[model samples]
Every structure is written in C-alpha cells, then in structure tokens.
Target chain A: MLEDGNLVFAACIILMTAATYFTRAGGLFIISKITPPPRISAFLNHVPASILVAIIVPSLAGKGPAEFISAAITAAAAVFTRNLILSLLTGLICISTLRAFVF
Target chain B: MKTSTNKSPGTRVVFSGKGIAEGFLKCIPLGIGVFAYGIVFGVLAVQAGMTPLQAQIMSLTVFAGASQLMALELWADHLPVLALTATVFAVNLRHLLMGAAMRDWLVRLPPSKTYFSLFFLTDESWALSVREMASGRKDAGFFLGSGLCIYVFWNSATGLGATMSSLVDRYFRDPSVLGLDFAFTAVFLSLLIFFWKGKSQLPVWLIAGIVAWLFFLVLPGKWYIILGGLAGGIVGALRDA
Candidate 1:
C-alpha cells in the first residue's frame, strides 16, 4: 500500500515520527549535554502535575453536570480505594448510569 | 553527557528481567483502558478514510494517540506535511519535560539502555515509572515493560477497531453514551489524587485550571493545554524558588 500511491503520506508519517522521537529524547539529550539551572529543574518538577491539571481542567470545564459529579465521584473513589482501575470503573459506571437515567 | 553510573542521590537503577516482568504485570489493568481508546482511534481512522494498514503504520511509528488523531483531522488527498508534522511536535512537546524528569532515574544507565527505554515513553508509562521510582523501587525496566504492555493492547485494539469499524460504528454512535469519552479524564482525575502535594500546591492547580479554561475559550487547537500547563509550572516554580 505504501509502495505506489502513498509516497507523500508516507513522507508525512516519517516526518511525524522524527518530530515525535525528537521530543521524547530531546529533554534527556539536552540535559545530558549540560546541567540545567536549579529553577529550570524546579520547573520540570512541577510540569508533570501542572500539565495533568491543565489537560483535565479544560476538559472538565467543557462538560456538564454528570461529568462533574462523576469526576468528583472518581476522585473520591480513588482516594478511598487507592485503586486506579476501581476508581475509573466507578467513574465510568457513574457517568453511564447518570447519562442514562438521571440526566 | 556527564553521567555517573556510580553515584545517585538515592536508589540504584535496577534493570533486570524480574523488574521488567513486575512492571509488565502491574500495567495490565491500565492496558485494558488503553485498549478502549485504541479501538476508538481505529474506528475513527476508518471513518476518516484511512485504510487499516495505514492506521496501524501510524500507530506503530508515531505511537502517540493525540497526535495521530490530530493527523486525521488534518488528513486530506495531499497531506499538509508541514502542518501535520508541526502539530505532531506541538502536541508531543510535553514529552520534552516528561523525558527530562527521567534524567535522574535514567542517568545511571548506558546510552543504549537509556534511549531504548526512552523510545517507548508515553504518559501512562511515565506515570507508572515515576511512582515506581518515587516509592524507592529502582527498576528502570518498569518504564519499558509497562510501555510494552500499552503498546500491545493499543496496537492490537487498533487493528480490531479498523477491521470492525462498521460494527463499532453501528453499535456505538456516540462514545459519550458509553462514557468512553471520559476514559482519559477519569485516569487523570485519579492521578491528581496521587500527585496532590497538599494545600501548598492548590494555588498552582487552581491557576493551571483557570488558565486552561480561559485559553480553551480563546485559542484554537492544543495550545491551551501547553500554555495552561506552563502557566502552572511557572507559578509553582516561582513559589519554590
């Protein structure tokens, strides 16, 4: 399939693959070459949770009541059970049920 | 590249079959969640006019779900090569920070080991590895092993979704109806519990969430995520500094 008609598409894939691999390896590649300043390292430390929150907030804000309630339920389930899968299951079930019957 | 395999602040990096196996086994549950997304992506790719083979190739090579889905949005008769690749870079820019966080956890290993492990890095794998390392288990192999688990489920589900797109489309017209749309949100909401550093970090999250919401309203594409995440990171870093 990639042989005859898909050369441009294939090139796009290659470019994407290269660009992605760069991002994945670039941080270590740069850090290995030179030491990052303390503040920069601090920034990295905060980015993980910050990014997670950033991703979640916009998504959660865009949703409605069932979504908000389910998220709260999921967070509570996770804290109480200390189980990721169980909490996710609870959230999924809660949302499905609410969307079906309540909402 | 000045890395000392001889010394670290704490736990020694452990690379072994047992560690890898432990990582692999621990990730099975998360892998099931990943499979759901994979099937969703596969079904969408088919609808977007991609052949299953093409979708699998994209999945195998690019290996990032968000970027792949974005590519589909930008897909056309003649692909917008620059736009497609640029968006890929933008969406994955978070990885630069994530990979750097691995610096200490990975510095002790050889370049071969480091790069090999880094290639498989994804958000889920990185999360598991971070927790494992934080808990003082030194198995560097956990990153690779968990990533492999995700890789298996994600790719296999892609194939299944691509092949069975019709059945999925007919049955599940709206992923929201099944709450499949909330899978990642659910995953991240729960992760926030573990990442919660207490009231001290509340301001950072509050700022991040507010900034993200504002930008989501104003900007297009995935820029809000990056901008909002950076805003949180900057505020948190300033407080720490």
Candidate 2:
C-alpha cells in the first residue's frame, strides 16, 4: 500500500532519525551497565578523527589537481591558525579561485 | 570565567540560563562552520532530487552533518531504503561511543532531559561539552545550549541553501565547477585536525586513510568509510593495549 515516493521518503527520514537516536540513548544505557575501559575510551577519542580522515581520503585521492591544492591550502590554514571557520573559508575560496582562473 | 549561579556548594550538576548563554556564546564560532556545511548539504540534497521541504525536514530531524551528507549522496529515485539505512547506521555508530563517554555527566539528569538532549549530540557539541566538563563545569545546560545553537544554525542554513539551490544552479551550472563538491571533504579534514590529540593518533589516521583509499578502488558503495573507521579503531585500541 505504501507506493508513493513521498511517503517512502518520509518513512526513510523517520527511520534515520530513530536509528540515530538509538545510538545516542543506547550508549548511555549500555554504559550504565558496564564502564568502558580506559583503552576503549582512548580508542573512542581517536575514532572521530579517524572517521573524518576515512571520509575525506577517498574523495581527495581521486580528485584533480585543483582539489589537491585546495586541500593542502585548507590543511595548512587549519594547522597554522587552528581555526575551523578560517580553514573552511580557505578551502572554499582557494578552490573557487583556482577553478575560476587557473583551471 | 563565569560560574553557574544555580549551584549550591554540594550540588554536582547545575542547569541554568547563565550556563546556557555561555555555552551558546562559546559555540558561535563553530556554528559558522556548521552553517556553511549545512548550506552545501542543502544545495546537494535538492540536486539529488529532494524537495526543499524534504531537505529541511532531514536537517531538522537528523541534524548530523556527515550522515546527512551521506544520505544525500545515496539518494535516488527508487530510494534504496535498506542500503541507505545501513550506511547511516554505520556512519552514526560513533555516536554510541560519544554518548557512552558522557554517561557520567548525562546520568545526573532526568531521563527525559538526558535523552532529549542526546537528540542534538553532534560532533561539535560533543567536543565542546567534553571540554567544558574537563574544565570542571557540570552544568547540563551548557550541553543543551551548545546543541541548540548548532541545531538552529544547521536547520536555517539548510533551508536557505535549499531555497537558493535553483539560483546557484542557474549561475554555476555545476557545483563542482566552484569546487563545492569538495566542501564535504574539506570540512571533514578541518574537523579531523581540530580533534587531533597527539602524535599517537598519527598511526590511526594513516591506517584509516590507506584502508579507505584501498577500499575506494575496490568497493562499489561507501562501505569503505565504515571499514576504514573500524580498522583505525581496532589499531588504536591495540596500540593502547
């Protein structure tokens, strides 16, 4: 009976929301039963950065020279400034400028 | 350094307007990054066949940047429900650990308030709240406030970006021409640097990046993300042992 694309999309969104909430709340429940070890916490601390690198590396690896240059510029900006907004702006501006004129 | 006025000498947790305001103020700088990322997601969502309303709803409900972007990337006419759900679950599994790490702090709140606040637990809010807790502040309002700021900025920016997508399309024709497609990668990289702890994390980053790159060459879908993250986490755990 659920044949409409709109209905399906709404359902998908609800499902995603439910699934995400489960992860957040469920973690608290699980933690209450047993404390995560120090090693696990250390690993968890590293996971976020690792996941970000994982998400980014594939896209960066297959991209063009402009993408490469812009990524480096962004990385350098992040390293030197330690500011998220500035680094993002650096990437956005650098890539757009390179594409507009150089590429 | 403003202290919460609602706290008594023995009180372990305080939720107050002043703490909320401070948390919101602390989040403003990072909120810009969230807004920029949300705008890109909005533009991409419309391009991927979502109506502006649908995109807005996703932003309001889901709110996690990486998972939402991944959803847009996986969006299609038929709506591959199972695949999309699996990808989202995989990508967001990290929230489990993030929430777990905050259990000591969140456990002090009433269950309703605790879970309600968890709905807005993004990487940015989590990082900020963790730092706040480390500084010996136990105000739950700080967490709620930080999450609220991000939620507002993310949803509004997404709505604006979705509204402006048509204009952007007419002018730029292709998002990649302006390198907007790379925005996700750039944003993630910047965040990774922000969360960088020490030299000990270098191996984890290298291992994850290499695994992800290898999987990108062989895999058809986005399993590489989950695989690479798992590989890095395993190595990190082992290294600690």
Candidate 3:
C-alpha cells in the first residue's frame, strides 16, 4: 500500500488507460449506428452541460468558506472574461495567496 | 469545367481559406489550456512510475484529461486494479453521449474525416462542434476542421509537456497542483455557461448540479457523473415541458 510504489503505480496507469479506452471506443463504435431521436437527441444535448456542472460542484465540496469564496470569485472572473486560462490563473493566484495569508 | 465554372461568394466563404483559418484561430484560447494540462498529465503519469514511452502512449491514445488524472490519483491511493479500472470506465461513460450527439453531424463525412475527428473529441472541441451544429452548420467539415486543430495542439503539447517535465525536476516533482485540475473544472464550467442560454434553463442546471454534488458525496464511485447527468437531464426535460 505504499503510495507511489512502482508496481501499484504502473498497474493503475495501465488499468486506467484500458478502462478509459473501453468507454471512448464504445462511443466511437456506437456513433456509427443508432441515430438518436428527437426526444433522445434533445435529452443528450442537455447531457454535456449537466455532466460538467456535476463534475465541478463535487470538487468544491469540503472546502472551507474561504476557498469557496475564492472559487466563487474565480467563477465570476471566468464568466465575465470568458477566458478559461485567465479564470484558472486568477483562481490559482487567489487560492495560493489566501493560503499564504490565512493559513 | 461547368461545375467549377462559377461559384458564389457565399460558397467560397463557406469553403474559404479564411473559414479554415478562422476555425483554427477560434481554437487558440482553448488549445493553450489543453496543452498545459496535457503536460501535467504526462508528468503525473511518469511520476507515477510509467516509463516516458508508456506515459506518452497513454496520453496519445486515451487523450481524456479527467480519466488520466483520476487514474493517477487512484494509483497514488493504492486502490486495487479492478477498482481503478472501474473508476476510469465510469468517469468516461459520458463521452458516449458526446459521441452519439456528433453522429448525425459526422454520418455524411468521409470515413477518414470521421475517424480523424475522434481524436479531437474532448470537452472543448465537443462544445465548439455542438454550438456550431446548433447554429445549423450541418457541413461536417466545420467539425472536422475544428477537431483537427484541437487534436494537433493536444498531442503536440502532450509531447512538449512531457519533454519539459523531464528537464525541470522541481517543476515535474508535483502535479501542477492547481494548474491543470483547475483548468479541467474551469473548462467544464465554461461549457455550462455557454450552453445555458437564458434564465429559463438556469434553475434546472442548478438543480442538476446540486444533485450531482449530492450523489458524488454519497456514492461510492465515479458513477455520480452518470447519476447527476440523468437527474439533471430529467429535470431539465420536464422543465422544458
């Protein structure tokens, strides 16, 4: 159970790579068939944004109020700027700076 | 010669050098983030003990950011191989939906283009293609062009990031803790903001997001994305009704 132990690490990478390929390949294969219907198409259209927010929200869980504030500030900057790199840079600067001062 | 004898300005614009250049230019902002993050993944994979060749191949082949990161994290956690595999599969399941969405757009493209476009099927490229498709650009070349540009940047950056990682031991020492991961989250949010056009869709997305978080909190594995996606999807569909 040693973290970064060589055997464990390699196995993790290989397994993760295999599993991810399986899913992505599944999509590539399925795209060749089964044209999505209107209702289904509409439903799938909503899936990406939904999946995105779902991914982001859980990431913010368990943070202190300060980190949350930092994230919120970052999110606002991101929204206003519509610049992904800028938003992330601002968030990083804000969080690291806050950690330096607050902790 | 009759067919090529005359073409309208509009047709020329559609297939113009300007159109292709414009597509590549549009992808620049998104490309920088993708390349930087790709480097982080490459470095992390190497740090996790894969040889450089192994790490590079994984990035080249798999090409999904979150899955690579999650795998490295799980490896660090010492999770069993089966569990790690399962997590990777679960996290990437959403791409199936993404792929299916692109099918209609790709069905008519030549087989080579269809296959090549798959390489650029990350979240950003998908979002760009989806938005273009939504705007009624049924010509698959737009997607093909956009996907090709992003693909080039992604793979090249992966190589550069991996190479860069080897030079600066300190830089390669830790994952760019907040660097690429934050970009991952930021890219996802940007997609959400773009897709949410008005206040009408706002509440539904918010609820879906909350539900995703709750599931992620409670669920044992990566299935939370699927759960959150379904819950949010159903809510949004109902609200649209």
Candidate 4:
C-alpha cells in the first residue's frame, strides 16, 4: 500500500536504525572477547567525563556572552547543589532572563 | 560482585519494580529538558517535510537526539540513503564507547535482558546509570526505568510538536526565545560537574575539551565528539599506565 517515495524513506529510516544499533551494541561484543586491562578500565571510567566535556566544550567555545554567563551559572548551581533539576532550571531561567531583558 | 555470586539463579535477574520506580523518579528532573529537545526536533522534522507519522516513527525507532537532528537537516525531497546512513553512523559512534563503559554491569545478565535494556541507552540515561553505579546500586532496572521515562516523554513530545507544528512555531519562534535551546548544554554541564574528580580527571577533561573544540571549529560534521572522546580516552589510559 506504500508509494515508491514513501518506501525509500522507510528504507532509509530502517537502515539508519540498524547502523545506530550497531554502535550501541558493538562495544559489548568487542569487550566480551578480551579482559580489559586496568589502564583500559581506568580509561573507560574517565570516558563519561571526557565525552561530557566533548559535548559541551564546542557549545561553550566561540559563543556569545549570554551563553557563557548562563553556562557558568548552570555549572555553579550543579557543583554547589549537585542537583540536576536545580541546575537545569537555573540555566534555563538565566538564559531566558538574559535574552528577554538584559541582552 | 558479591551480590552477583551469592544470588540464586532465579534471583539473579536484575530487574526490580522498586528500582525501576526509583530510577523513573530520579530521572524526572531531567525529563523536562529531554521533552524540550524532543519538541524542538518534532517541530524541525515537520518543517523538514516529514509527516507527523514519519517524524514519530523516527523518534520511536531511532531515539537519538543529535543524530536525529542531523538526519532532519539532511532530509530532502528524495532520500539520500547513503549520506544519511554515514552521517548517523558518525554521529552515534560514541555509543560504542558508552556500551563498553557499561560492559561489566551489562555482561552479568542474560543476553536478552542485556540487549533489550541497552536499546534505551541514551546520553541522559547512561549518565544517570553511571551515577547510580557510582552510588553502589547495580540494578539494571534503574537504567531501563530511566530509559523508559525519557523514551515515553520524548516520543510524546515529538508527536505533540509534529501535530501542533504551527503552535510550536509561533511559541518557540526562536528556541532561544526562552533559552530552551541551552537546556541540553546546561544538562550536560551539570552532569559533567557531577562526574568531575579533582586533579585526576582534570587533564583528561581538558584534553577532550580542547580536542573537541578544535574539531568543532575545523570539521564539517560531528566527528569532533568521537575524536575528542578517543583522544581523551587514550590520554587517560596513558596517564593510568
């Protein structure tokens, strides 16, 4: 019942899903074969932090004052309270305030 | 480790109702940010020419934020399957390391439960699960539960965004109108702080940040994420050695 164009789109989605799944599950398959060395374990432990940094640094770099200030506020809130909700809310509120009124 | 060995076969299963509920509750705080991004993606997908159904199906099946966004940017009148596939693979390559990081915790369970639960793994849920593990809880249900909450929230928000694209367009005129655009970055920063250790992690974080920023400036796509992750990981390993 599907048209040719719709069928192509569907195929693309299916392929994309398969490729994404490979990345998600591939590590487990590889890790099963070898006992990860201590250094590797330590590296893996540090990976989450590194990945987080990787995701955020680009956004922080070469951005306007508004983004910088809001991110700084968000970081402070997170570090001081260690509450995810509070920090996110603080960032959202700060940015909105800055954009709406200040900037 | 003690828990794994001491438990009987029947009791070895990791899913628990209480743990699932706790995870769901713990994730509620971050759910808002996830929903916000989902709505944004939904609106963008509609604008990209996807029907509400196509956009919803993508969310249901893919469930990845950055890759989905990239896919929408690339979506056209004709499906450029090869380019889209490559872009998605490049964008999501970090998941390999994420899965590897959780290998010990995941390998304990049967393959069915392990893979099924992993299907829900995302940056947010994985970060939450890492926190849970740090706190000495090993319940796989926590991961699944967190994933379930975000999954439901994301899909529903996407549907809402797609169906109400016009309303979303008017309100979210600029995603930054209310700084909703910064929500994802804010959430990531908070999580980064949560996982920060003193001198030990500083070097690795710096290296990753620097490398990622450099790549972001120079590269055309999201290769920066993978590049930074690899560079930092290698440096961390060397430091440990």
Candidate 5:
C-alpha cells in the first residue's frame, strides 16, 4: 500500500464509495427488514449527534486562541444565521484577523 | 393533488416530466450555492494532493459534500484506508434517515427510478424534494431532477476550482494564516449546531465529548469518535430507561 500509491488510492476510493452507497440503499431496503425496539431506536437517533459531538469537542479543546475564539464565534453565528457557509466565513474572518494581530 | 401520506398499493405515483422540471428549477438557487461550495472542496482537494482526475472521480462517485471534504482532511501521502472509510461512513450515516424518510414517497415510483434517485440524494436535494412531496407534489422524478442540478453544478465548480487552485496557492501560501486551517473545524461546529436536538441531549453530547477527549489524549487514531459516540448513545438509552 505504501509502495504503490495509485492502486491503494483507487482501492480506498472504491471502498469509500461502497460504504456511502450502502448507507443510501440500506436505509431503503434493510430498514423494513428488522424492527428496532424503541430504546434501540433512541440509541440510533442519538448516535449520529453524539458522533458529531465526539468529532467537534476534541477538535475545539486545547486549540490556540485564534482557533478557539473563532470556533466560539462560529457557533454563535451558526445559531443566529443557521447558515453553514456564513458561520464558516465568520470563523475564517475572525481567525484570520486574530491570528494576524491579536493572538 | 397529492398529500403527504403513504400511497396505497393501488395508487399510482407518476414520475412526470413536469415534476422533474419543477424540481430542477426550484433547486437552481441552491445549486448555485453548492457550486461555490464545490469550488472550495476542489481547491482543498488539490491542496490535499489529489490530482484533478482523482478528485473528479471521487466527486462523481461519492457526490456528497460534507463526507468528501471530511475525507480530504484525512487524506495523506499514504492513504489510511480504514480511517478514511470509517470517517466517511460515520459522517454520512445521517443519510440513512434521509433515505428512510423518502421511503413513503419514492417507494411508489418504479424500483429503477426509485433506487437511481437515491444515488443523487444530498442535503439540499432531499430537503427540497421532501418539501415538494409534502406540499401535494407527488412527482417522484422531482428528487432526481433536483439532484441532477446539484450534480452538474458541483462537478463543474470542482473542475474550475482545480484549475484555479494554483492562483489560490499563489495568494495564500500559508493556509493557517489565511485561516484555512479552521475550515473543517468550522464546518463541524455548524454541523453540531444543526444536530443539537435540545437540552435533553446535552448529557449525551457531554459524555461523548468528554470520552472522546480522553481517548484523543490517551490513544491514537479516529476510533475515539466511535467509542465516544457509542458511549453517549448508551448513556442516552440508560437515561430514558
């Protein structure tokens, strides 16, 4: 895998593609196959958001001032604007300016 | 007029051209935003060392913006196949709901069209198609049409961004100074906001974050996310029980 980059690259991409398609099709077909209990359903529902929280929290912790402050501001903007792009822009602008001059 | 109810076995759902046209037209504005966002991905893909052909193929096959961008963040000189695929699945798992939600509406269409439409499902297209279906528009082809609009714009913008990447590189040599380092972080933060259900889920999120942070400090790799996510869910289940 390390020696041959292209082959590994193509193989990885194919695997990713398959994984993505599985989620799309699985929900369509397999969802009707087995019924999950309500507790299981609650777990399933909460899992994705938890996963996102897992990804975001570690990312925010122990970061520099610029990145940290920018993230806070971005979260605020996201709550207000609810626009991903706008929130992203707010973070980028804040981080850029803060990194340049403040912190 | 169609209502937002499951079709009876005898009911016929027409995948009409008019539905497709309306879906496509209604999505044009959203598609424009997707195009611009695709450019950012394109530029980032190039920065991550993907050739234009490689990036385009990923875009063509995956056709998912958030997951694709997230994959690029995990890209490396030597591809960590497990990490990359796992991260992609974790991020894209939300699609399962979007897919199941469409079951009532799309199941009435022919299996071929129904399954094909799932290939193009994105957040924007899904939202538009669901709204239309709920608004008495039973045109199953609408989902396909809206997805196609986004597909075209996203691919075109990706190519353009790949070509223009050199210009961006020239202007912004240090990505950190330009705040590009925070791009993925910003995306994730906003996603967290969108996914925030309510104060009820706060305990779940808190446990997930604390567990994830612990593992991130003590261990390596992305497994922290899965472990933390599962732990949080289990906590939620226990809380409810």
Candidate 6:
C-alpha cells in the first residue's frame, strides 16, 4: 500500500502473485469439477495463439510502412518454411537492417 | 539409461533438478538479455528512492518486467499510490488466468509450498508452464523443475544486474552496444512461428494483425492488446465454426 520503493516492489510481488494465483485457481477449480463444453474446450485451445498475436501485432503496428511490409514478408517466410528460429531471425534482420539503413 | 531408471522419490528430485539445470542453461542467452533489461529497472527503482535491498526484493517478489516497468513509470509520474496499485493489478490481469490453469497441479502441494511457488509466477514462467501443461504434463514436479529454474535465475540475475549496473557500465560502456534490445520481438516472432499450426490459421492471423493495427491507431493505452486479442479470437473461432 505504501509508495516507498522497497514497499512498492513488495506490493507488486504480493499483488501480482495473488492475482495470478486467483486466475489459475478459478480455472482449475471450475474445470476439474465439470466437463467443459466442446465449444469452451475449443476456445481454450486457441487462447495461447490468440494471445500471442494479441501481444505481437500491436507492437508491429507502431512501425513504418516498409517495416510493416517486410514484417509481413518475414511472417510469410516463417509460415512457408515452418522454421521458428529462422523466421524470427529473418524478421529481426529485416527490421534492424531497415532501421539502421532506411531510417 | 540406468540413471533415467533410478526409481527413487529422489529420482523425481534429481529429474526436477536436472530439468531446472537444463532450463537454466537453455535460458542463458535470453537470461543475459533479461539481465541487461533488469539494469534499467534497477536504476529506476534506485532513482525512485528504493534501497538496494528493496530493489532486489522487487525482482525477488514481483518479477514481471513489464509490470515493474509500468509501476516505475507510474511512480515517476507521481500518480497516487492507489492508482499505481490499480495500474499494476490491471497490467498483470492475464496472470490470473495463468494461475488458474496451474491450480490443479498446485492443489497437490502443501499449502505452504503452493503459497510460496505462486510468488514466482510471471509471464515467461506462465508461458513456459502453459506450453508444458497443454501437452498434458502429469508430473507436478516437471513444472516445479522448470518454474524454479526460471525463478532463481531471474531474481539472481536481476539482483546482480541492478547491483552491478554502475560498475558494469563503467567497464563495459554503452551496454546497448550488446544489441539486447530486440530480443523480445525476436522471441515473440519465434514463438509465433512455432505456434502457427498450419495454413488454416493463416487468415485468422492476418485478421488479427489488421485488427491490432487498427486498434492501436484508434484506441489509447494498452487496450490494443485486449481489443486485438478478442478481435483475433473471434475471427479464429468464427472461421473454425
């Protein structure tokens, strides 16, 4: 509750830990008791990928048009190649080189 | 093979330990970047009038990089304590679902153990755990193995990073020269590729990208994350439906 630097850190630890626990606990508690509907299960299955796109796309939005276009290219390469590391490295090289040279 | 067959409860302990070791080892490059990033957080904590011990404790306890950064930003802006508190809570709201998913594994542990382990949960840990859990990992010990590895290294690295930043900077000079800044986007893109599944999901992904860009332009604050996620989820579901 206090704003002292140390206290703030302590508070964050306690608050974040508690919040994370409650969310997980809610799912574990409820899901264990009942069989989730097929629809719900399907939704849960997609959640992680949805969340990933959720987090990534916004950050990419802040870039320039060329960066955006190249990133799209990079994403396409990733899908086509199905190589995680390669795709990411390609995106990094694309964006960083663009940043270093173009802008 | 014989080592893998050692049928002792200590086997669980040993496996957990080995898993932790491997996890830590795998995390080295990523960990180094995290350490560099931690320095920035540490400096901000110290600047905000926190003692070194307090700064270490933040890394020890809270341990979420984004949440910590947001909290520091809010503090610097002189936001009310309540507002700062609320902002921290809101920023970390996703972890609640993460925690809930891990609850069954948690239920097996003693109250004290579960209580303590919960303290170390973060986005990275949760991401790692969810990956393991979704693949139907039955052993609570596997998570303990992975999660503990993450917890120890993260805190130690942050504490050490914060403690050494001044001296490290003087010796190393221009830490940004290391190119650690782009690691997150790189990591995300890597994970994204790994999770893409197949061509069926491509349109959904594209729609998600477009929605996120539109939301970022139209919305303020971090709503882009939420809006983009919901928008993407709906599109994904509708296509499958």
Best by DockQ: 4
After the best TM-score superposition of candidate 3, give how far the Cα of residue B122 lies from its true spot, in angstroms: 1.7
lDDT of 5 at A58: 83
Ranking by DockQ: 4, 1, 2, 5, 3, 6
lDDT score, candidate 2, position B108: 68
Write one digit per residue (lDDT tens) for candidate 6, span A7-103: 6555555765555446434444565456666655555555556656766777665657645755676778776876544665676676667666776
lDDT of 4 by residue, B1-241 (tens): 2122213353343667777787888887667677888898899999999999999999999888889999988899888999999998888888888888776567766677668877888878888787776656767778778888888889998999999999987886455655666887998899888887687888899999999999999996678877888889989999988
Over 4 Å off, model 4 = B1-13
RMSD of every candidate to native, in Å, equals 3.1, 4.9, 6.4, 3.2, 6.6, 5.8
Candidate 3: the clashing residue pairs are none
TM-score of each candidate structure, all chains considered together: 0.90, 0.71, 0.70, 0.90, 0.61, 0.72
Which DockQ-derived CAPRI band holds candidate 2? medium
Runs of candidate 5 with Cα error greater than 4 angstroms are A1-16, A27-29, A77-89, B1-51, B63-154, B161-168, B172-184, B187-191, B194-198, B215-225
lDDT of 4 at B2: 12
TM-score of 4: 0.90
TM-score of predicted chain B, candidate 3: 0.72
Q: DockQ of candidate 5?
A: 0.45
- Give the C-alpha miss distance for residue A80 in model 1, angstroms: 2.1
For B95-183, candidate 1 gives per-residue lDDT tens digits of 88778777766776778878888878887777777767755777687877888888888899899999999998778555566787787
- Among incorrect, acceptable, medium and high, the docking class of model 3 is acceptable
lDDT of 2 by residue, B1-241 (tens): 3233222345477667777777788777567667777877888899999889999998888777888888887798889887777777877876776676576467767776778888888877766676567557878778878888889889988998899997764554444655567766676777677666678789999998999889879975566766677778879889888
DockQ, all models = 0.71, 0.52, 0.38, 0.74, 0.45, 0.36
Better of 5 and 6 by TM-score: 6
Highest lDDT model number: 4
Better of 1 and 4 by DockQ: 4
Question: lDDT tens digits, residues A3-75, model 1?
Answer: 6448887888899999989998998888887777888877777777777788789888868999999999999
Q: Report the lDDT tens digits of candidate 5 across residue range B1-241.
A: 3223334665456776777777888777567667767878888999899998888988898888878888898898978998988877876775675566565467666667777878888766766675556446666878888888989989987887777888855664444555655766776677678766579989889998999899879865455666777788789888886
Candidate 4 chain A lDDT trough over 10 residues, lowest sum: A28-37
